[model samples]
Target: MSLLPNTMRAVAATGSVPLDDERALADVDLPLPELRPRDVLVEVAAVSVNPVDVKTRMRRPADAPRIVLGYDAAGTVVGVGSEVTLFAPGDEVYHAGVITRQGTNAEFHAVDERLVGRKPANLSMAEAAAMPLTTITAWESLFDRFRLDASSGGTLLAVAAAGGVGSILTQLAATLTGVSVIGTASRPETRDWVRGMGAAHVVDHHGDLAAAVREIAPDGIDRVFTPSTAGRLPLYADVLRPFGEIVAIDEDPDMDARVLKSKSIAWLWESMFTRGVFETPDMIRQHELLDEASAMFEDGRLRSTLAREIAGIDAAGLREAHALVASGRSIGKVVLVR
Candidate 1:
């Protein structure tokens, strides 16, 4: 702690502007964040950009203070709070920080130890950084929302299976449970990528989703996982069996729940930030799940979805990364490294 610096370099959203605008993100100097009772300070080595970063930047008010925006990070512990127990100085870790705090796009960051995990031995910082947020989201969707397990036998339809969360979700379902996975991807490359991740089938989302899914699973799907629910609930209802479930991560203002009433289909939302944001008693589950995922990664049962890496945690690089992610076509995850 005595060797720690007072200030650190960071990248932040200076104003709510388009990704191409120079004012969208900028380099800044920030004081080292204060550690809370259960907090640990980390020296960040790599961070991955998600869709949340782009959304936050675009939706932020012009008068709001410059806010740093990043979530997924892989780094080394450098300092610990009085109540911290899970990590010590020099321990390498990875985490997807809560949305309530300033983020991980900095030289140093402070995060709750309950949200951190030991970095997988086989992964580089960039690769590990690409995992935390997507991994948590996907894991919760399958295990917590859908309640699938090793004994569970069914068919799962994963929309956008080549995206960050979908890539890991497909792998987890295929490897950890008895379910068969049908992934949706429009492009040839992404379809191949989804299949490589362990999907039993890959269908074109640009075509008739219900018909395509029916051709593969004639009996109807047992579960559906999607990032977006805009204007697609009816199609999901049509393809899901009676008493099936749908887990989604995005917000859709026009979504109607009545479509599933007749079939008794359950529609659930999965937000990895819920436990941390509310300081729920079960917040520590994130730590446990991440450690479990680490073991899976180390044993070769899971793999990193890092598709692109940019050098340095600077505003220019982050802007490029953010724009790529905002394009809605980038496969897997994009990371920035020091």
Candidate 2:
């Protein structure tokens, strides 16, 4: 087999957004890695678009030369750093790239062994690409935030349950715990999408979430996770039982926590990248969790969340994917094969 070549092309934002800013994530030159110890050089095969890309592109520093703009990907490792212990050359892997680093929107990406995991055996690279970001975000939010026991019984309420994160969150929680999942979605198609992901019950977010949730059980839910951008707290607070915990990945400056007084709620903001950012002792936990999740996928307990698989890796496909996520109605995920 031919060894992978150095140097690659990638999509990068050279200016600010509103993408109309003339240089928002166009094609750019990227350097290849020099084979750092304990690192793996993966030949990128596919990537997924998440809300973070859109947000980063919208707020990227204008003066930077050009910022690579993707996080989730699946690829074959062409080279492994000398000290690497887990993956070997030729192993296929999927992971969410570190935030401060150049992304996998290129032909190759050098990843820390701690952030990547073996891709599921049944999934193609495109299918595998759709999972990492949503799965990483959802897994950390519920498992890390609540410390949920794998065998515990509880009711999980997922707000905005048709989006990428919600889709995986519902399935993972449902499969890992005895918890019955109740997911909220407003549209008929979204309702079906959430149901297909293993949600035991569905409520419309358009109605009073508390009322809609109460209709299912007079007793409120045990845990809530929302990936919503705005007006999320009150909705979660309304349906959460006494001392029920809630977590969100988004920060709305206007959001007030005072409303959480009732239920003696535990509300937290979850960022999957926090461990990596702080170099916390548990940064390797992401690697372990993704491995476990992949095993579940292999076991047929969890399904891939990819909804749309676009062909070819390029700026136009990425832009279209980003727009779909920004529209807030996308169910599952979108993957672009390189």
**What RMSD, rounded to one decimal, does every model reach?**
0.8, 1.9
Give the C-alpha miss distance for residue 295 in model 2, angstroms.
1.5
Q: What are the per-residue Cα lDDT tens digits for candidate 1 across 1-338? A: 88999999999796677777777898999999999999999999999999988888778887788898899999999999999999999999999999999899999999999999999999999999999999999999999998889999989999999999999999999999999999999999999999999999999999998999999988899999999789999999999999999999998898889999999999899999998999899999999999999999999999999999999999999989998998889999999999
**Estimated TM-score per prediction?**
0.99, 0.94
After superposing all C-alphas onto the true structure, candidate 2 shows an RMSD in angstroms of: 1.9
Best candidate per lDDT, number?
A: 1
Whole-model lDDT values for every prediction = 0.94, 0.83
Model 1 root-mean-square deviation: 0.8
Evaluated against the true structure, the overall lDDT of model 2 is: 0.83
Top model number, TM-score: 1
What 10-residue stretch in candidate 2 is worst by lDDT?
14-23
Q: After superposition, how far is residue 125 of candidate 2 from its true place, in Å?
A: 0.4
